[model samples]
Target chain A: MTSALETADNPQDMKRIVIEPLTRVEGHGKVTLLQGSNRSIQQARLHITEFRGFEKFIQGRPYWELPVLVQRLCGICPVSHHLAAAKATDMIVGASELTPTAEKIRRLMHFGQTLQSHALHFFHLCSPDLLFGFDDDIRHRNIVGIIEDSPEIARQGVLLRKYGQEVIRITSGKRIHGTGAIPGGINKSLTQKEIRYLQGDIGQMIAWSQGALELLKKVFFEHYNYHLGFGSIESNMMSMIRADGAFELYHGGLRARDRNGESIFDHNDYRNYDQYIRESVKDWSYMKFPFISALGQENGWYRVGPLARVNNCDFFSTPLAEEARKEFIAIGDGKPVQSTLGYHWARLIELLHCAEAIAELLGDRDLVGKELRNMGNLQSSGTGVIEAPRGTLFHHYEIDELGIVTKASLIVSTTNNNQAMNESIRKVANQYLDGHRLTEALLNQVEVAIRAYDPCLSCATHAIGKMPMELNLCDDDGELIDRLEKRADGRISRTI
Target chain B: MSTDKTFRMDGKAIPFEAGETVMDAALRAGEYIPHLCHNPNFPPHGSCRVCVVDVNGKHMCSCTLEAAEHMEVDNSSDAIIDKRRTLLQMLFVEGNHTCPACEKSGDCQLQAVAYHTRMLSPHFTHFFPKRSIDPSHPDMMFYYNRCILCGLCVRVSRDVDKKSVFAISGRGIDSRLVFNSPSGKLGDSDFSATDEAAKVCPVGAILPKHVGYETPIGQRLYDNKPISVVGDTIAKNHSEKPVVIGGPHE
Candidate 1:
């Protein structure tokens, strides 16, 4: 838009610059930078503008519908919501323990989701900045740019997305909003034909995943210092871990590791999460800042997602991922990886883990077994937590006697990383922004930091092309000094 | 003449009995007319207007219009298809027919008919008219949101079950399926889950309470094939055997 990083000298002494509706992320958001007379950023905030009252709206719906209906929150990761809600409803329906077939099929679906989502975030959203310099041509700097510069990467990404979707389609029914998982168990099993279909491309997917991880490692090492220091922040890490403290995405006890890689709490049941975690809201942002309750607001803010999961877990279950994790975690030197860009590397490792997990589940005969569902004693209330691609997702529901959800509290993955994303953006702004100028490249760097968390800001409120990028530079008197508008088609307009 | 005894629907000859509606004649010929209110086992009542076909370039409800000899019916014209799609869109927006989680999702006549007509999206802004669920019935559950006011339950209950247990109240946009019971709940009425009326609902409005999703989603009657091929699978959902979870459930 502005030659990627063309200087926007504020000779007129603009007080603050605001960037609205970020490009290339799942949804739109705004960032405001307040600069002082010195060549430094005084204040920076990544404001979440949209309010998705999903928890409130979900109340009064039939609890069974929660799995299918709540997935509408985000187009990218609907399966997480589907399975999370199904898990909660499983308790309500008294299906305390799912049949082996049902649980395995669900696990297979989660792996597919993780693979596709991580692939999309890397190749489509973050690759241009990583592969091509962030300061390169403004126009050719997205998925289109990737296609022109590296078509193989683009094809790999698209096919990976399709392969993952096919896994979902077979397991859930439709790729996006499949009605596969129900209260007690899944609706159906993977037929032999379906299993064969998935097994066909999984090897390719795994190889591609390894290749991509290697590529990312090479890219990181080439710009090793800059990549490590860019937007880096030290924070607590959190995720769901297996009882044995291995990496677990589907179901596990709660775990949070401090910056020193020591446990804040481990192996605790997540049902009492409210006692450990608390959310506080700021007036400037629509998102709530969740912190570990005992640590209090100032020190309790923690990050969740791939980087957090990899850091907090003891080891990876799959051999390839375990090897990769060891190599990757060696970078931290027995400490949690606090570098923001390290998120990309962590995500690729998980993608490889998913591919391997999918291959293992394909051979399991339980997937095709007939014992699909089992019911236990009924319960009125239940909670479900799972490791979504973005982070840890929580869904809790209390249904009335008539099986209607009377209360619901949903904490989506992106929401869990809200504070971490804000912290990352603040670090980027401090490092890149000069009080005298605000450039497109500098602004993009801010987004690059937030992209690490892969926040789905549109999870609750989604608007497509309607949300074009707009920036307003306002003075101390709250009067506009200069306005820069970037339309959906990449057209930029500036008026003073 | 043969033309005097038979009519052509999209150029297929359909012989009709006296007093038979166009929908009945086509259905008897084993052809699907993509309807919501018309069932072969019951009398045709064309209040939903989803089966409006072109006859001599005039739009008419096939479920209500009497079949005439030598009549030319256009059920597959672009104009007819567009009109059906528009009517379906209206029906979709007019009521809260959430197909994804509706117990009648894959099996629902409205959803199947929409699919058969290729109604990709509900084009109009939804009138998410708030409606309450009638879960008082021990054996049956009624989700009014999934109902399109198809009148199948009402008519079947009246004509087949002889209970006259259901009726539609209000006008136009305000119309909703109402129970005959004074408390306005299905539990207060004498409508049993085994009644033909319960089996005749084309949507999720009438369902066996505890036995929902007894048939998994993919292997469902309408899952593998379109409703046009499989036809009415909901008819076979009625159970003569007792349900283990039967009895009034809170």
Candidate 2:
């Protein structure tokens, strides 16, 4: 008697599952898993579908316009690009000698972005799977789901996002591109009364943020088995660490470390990044993977975004942020948890820290009366580096005597973690798909692992639509094997 | 009564609603106000702000301020005139308007308004912006430095004749009027021998680029030949005693 699971000897008995247009992620990608008859994994790949080209478009524009120009790159993290461009130009033009008040206002804007972006990433993007089980109706598993089960958290998300948007509005002079934030300085400063209002809101937000953190810790503890059972691939981590060796979400020296916390490159000299990072684009996708210099894909795997950030920084400046980091490190071997699930926890901790930092900056009296922007002579070249919600971002430019940009280049954060994301999906695919018919939950789990990277495919692709991703399985003779078709309803319509 | 306009002055009723300008309405209602660009013989030119008034929420040149219903208006107020003084100062500093060295110094409407408003000095910093001169035109010279962004040139070029050989470019503070063709030099534009865009320039910005220092300000046609002496007549009196200053439209 032959069992359905016992056909491992037959090569034709393998099953293939394909998940295309993976939803609830920043951009677009696909996950394809191959398994043998006994449900042992054969192969897996996270196929990305975007490319980066904003650097080429920046040439010939006036240097002062870059902050506004780069802001349109991503709606989710425009302020990051704006600040990065302004700082880069400031470095070139010697505008970094800003007053304490100006610096405080800038930090306030940065913290605001951190809070709102993290909330969106957590409640809106990833909560669906954790709250309801994977494959628990994707249509109903969004922020709306949180609103249904926890209306207060949903409202908090809205309020937090509004606070961030308001900071951008007040500081930069507009919420989006805010063409007013120039190289010399900003256009307008925040008033004392406005700071008091922000302080009041911050006081209210603290309780809500604490509750949210508690909820996240509860989720982490409750799902220990699933998280442990999830994919774990040892990879290098990269993020910005502050001057005093603390976690910094905005500006700092980037430290690229191995899985064991051994720093390979610890410097802020971004122009020399090409020597350490190598980017290559695949024909199937627009996203570029930057492997470690002189290393191939298998040996060169690095992760980024929140989990990588927490694993990297020794501690955070604020006491609350530090306590959260301690709680985060205590999970799974005390440091460098190999599972992608920890990204959510790291993000939540950063969110809490951002709120505290914003309140502190708002209370700084210098912020209310200082000059918003400084007037300066245009510089010939500059580079700005800042950490967006996803990871590190770089903007570099060379300008002519008239301040027209002659050259431009950008190193976005998503590119840094491409290899790790691919490997992450493979690890889970190997563990879950080993010789069995693909279950929707396992397939979803594979997608969720890739989502942990929070790859910005829209910025990567420089386009607005999904790419054509094909997934297929065949025997040695190229004859057809088991198959899964991507359906309009976003499920695997299949035959074995 | 049929040719009259109807509106309010400081919330008091008035008449003269048949498309007559707010300045004309105020003048008809015996409201004395200073003006530089409004010539009774010619159509109202709204470039100069000596007749500026605050209506509704915005400040407008009264010569061009269309009387709308229930429009809260403020004229001759210190705040309104202060802003107008700034605008006039911008015009004075932006151009090569050397009042003492100019041909139409004392009798020039621009100089008279400056004297009336008691403009002691250019309040804002001078831009000392660039300009061009065309001395090659047969009967006139065009000085572009003193050209204000009044739409008078655009209107004269399009409305009086069916031709529009001039248009403004680079909006906001960088705005500049350009000739219709690529040659760009005013002498080489498609402007005919009788294009009024040249004459509508209120300041010396568009004076004939040639024939310099010909008529002194007191002897120039605008100064010696006052409108009452020339009669309150239409602007096309080409046969009147010629000042040989230049053709109004070159």
Candidate 3:
């Protein structure tokens, strides 16, 4: 597939600008902008600068540890990794079906994970870009600034995230790095006290989730045309759906639809994912671009995550989210919403769906049932798939006779949407480039498009404490004009 | 027999047999003393320092110190809890005891004693010393990272199992658990899953693989109740199933 940088080099006429360690997203990434004479946008490429060798490092570890071990990859979506690995290893333990209590509790945990992850992205991360204009003051364009300026908005976001975290804490053991989901089934089910604790604030969570969706709709419609056209791309979409095509997150078969919303493939088993979906490597990025096999690599490269999930599902099981999904699909006018910014819209809908699902699950008595796990003849290989808050997440593992993880392959949500994210940023760069030199605001727009995907560079370097960051603004002749450094102590100083 | 030799602990008189240590005597008298390395089944080893009791106004390891008749020994005093917390803190930082990720977590004696002594954090800066994990064993995994150097497994394998499969090599921060095999892997060692050493780790160091987190965190040993109440030896019974113990020294 042709990339933005490949579209033009024009070495002599090109003036390059780089946005290093793109801010607010999960991990470190950079956007390289190539500008030609007369400020024509030459190219834009999203490069994942961090090395990801989690799959390689995890081999030979016991299979039981995979659910707890692999989750250290991303602090933001640890539960997604935890659950997906548990699901895959479930088959290895020979449990094709979990007990009712275990399945319900697992679903509750997944929904909670979706609720919190989506809220963090929509409210804390991307909301700054959407609520404040892309050109907002650099210092004030963040969740902290929102807390100071829009305290109510910030409070709701914090509370929403907290509610989801509480659900996770109660269902699983802790909020993060939980050991609730074990092979074959869950380790434990919810108790009466845990059930009551979760139910107490669940009503407020549902209301806040609905309000968040409404808030997104209002912001989206205020600049309807700009939001619709900004960073727009026509691409195929993919996700998992229930047997009857209802929007599903926990378990289902794969579905792929084209830009026109035509089903390219539906209900394809995730166990044979490699048979239908192929990942192609690019020399430019460490992440691979996954595409449909039938369409071939060129046209097969598609988008996943919330936008694809929203577009691919026929309807949502919950009434409120079903109404929201209808409003979302109506914007497409018969096709999938092609606007890159629509990701935020789709993400909020999922957040609402999870909230509603959490409320419904709270009333079920099975959540407090005794049966937690079942075991059968162990299998050698198994695959697990779940619609993570970001997108489709796949965890496949091959175990030895003694249940050691011989091999592991993961298609993280960020990796699945890698090509599409690059395309989105490229579109944003060109649209905002115009006939002027690159500004910090323009650089932010490119980052905003990438933020919509909420990519998690799994093996990101900044897992520990603060690191020094330097922002360099260069002149037309490639001379450094200004330098701003954020020191390890978080003190920002201009060195120019 | 009714007037058996005894030592006054707190306000109660703890009876003891001849050659019985304070820990053994107290446990035999239905008195609880928080300990990590000292088990009833194993001969007394004073390495953990968690069972420190104030005898005649001096801190001493109760497990190694012999019980004497009418001896005034204070257990669970304010000073003792403070020292145990500090000792636990050192043990916590000396090695990686990530209870959140550890399979032994709630069941581990170190964590349970930390909870009992209110050792909320590893007070000192973490040594984060280079440690290793040997996953070569099919049914067992040896995580030297979580090893507290208590010598329970070492003593159990040597004294009980009669195999001496595990031994603590080196000293101080450089100390590490080494297998008896030439390859230094448990899979090659004479250590069987049924060995007493397999169930003797007081921390998450010597774990039986493929059975982790099977008994969820909250329901595991020392979850609803403190280890003082439930006792560490009950791990073999409190687990989800038999033959794969989930608690302390397992």
lDDT of 3 by residue, A57-163 (tens): 77867788888888888778788899899889888888989999999999999999889888877777777778888888666666777888889988999899998
Question: lDDT value for candidate 3?
Answer: 0.81
Q: What stretches of model 1 exceed 4 Å from their correct place?
A: A1-14, A23-27, A455-467, A491-494, B1-5, B18-21, B52-61, B64-86, B118-126, B210-218, B221-224, B233-250
- Shift in Å, residue A287, candidate 1: 1.2
Least well predicted 10-residue stretch by lDDT in candidate 1 chain B? B241-250
- Candidate 1 vs candidate 2: which has greater lDDT? 1
**lDDT per residue (tens digit) for residues B144-221 in model 2:** 665666656665676565566777789787888777756776556667656655555555555542122323223344
The better candidate by DockQ, 2 or 3, is 3
**Residues A200-312, model 1: lDDT tens digits:** 99999999999889989999999999999998988999999999989999998999988898889998788788889899988767778889998988789899999999998
Output the number of the DockQ-best candidate: 3
Q: Rank the candidates by lDDT, best first.
A: 3, 1, 2
Q: What share of the true interface contacts does each candidate keep?
A: 0.26, 0.00, 0.66
Clash counts per candidate, in order, are 1, 32, 2
RMSD of each: 5.7, 15.4, 4.8
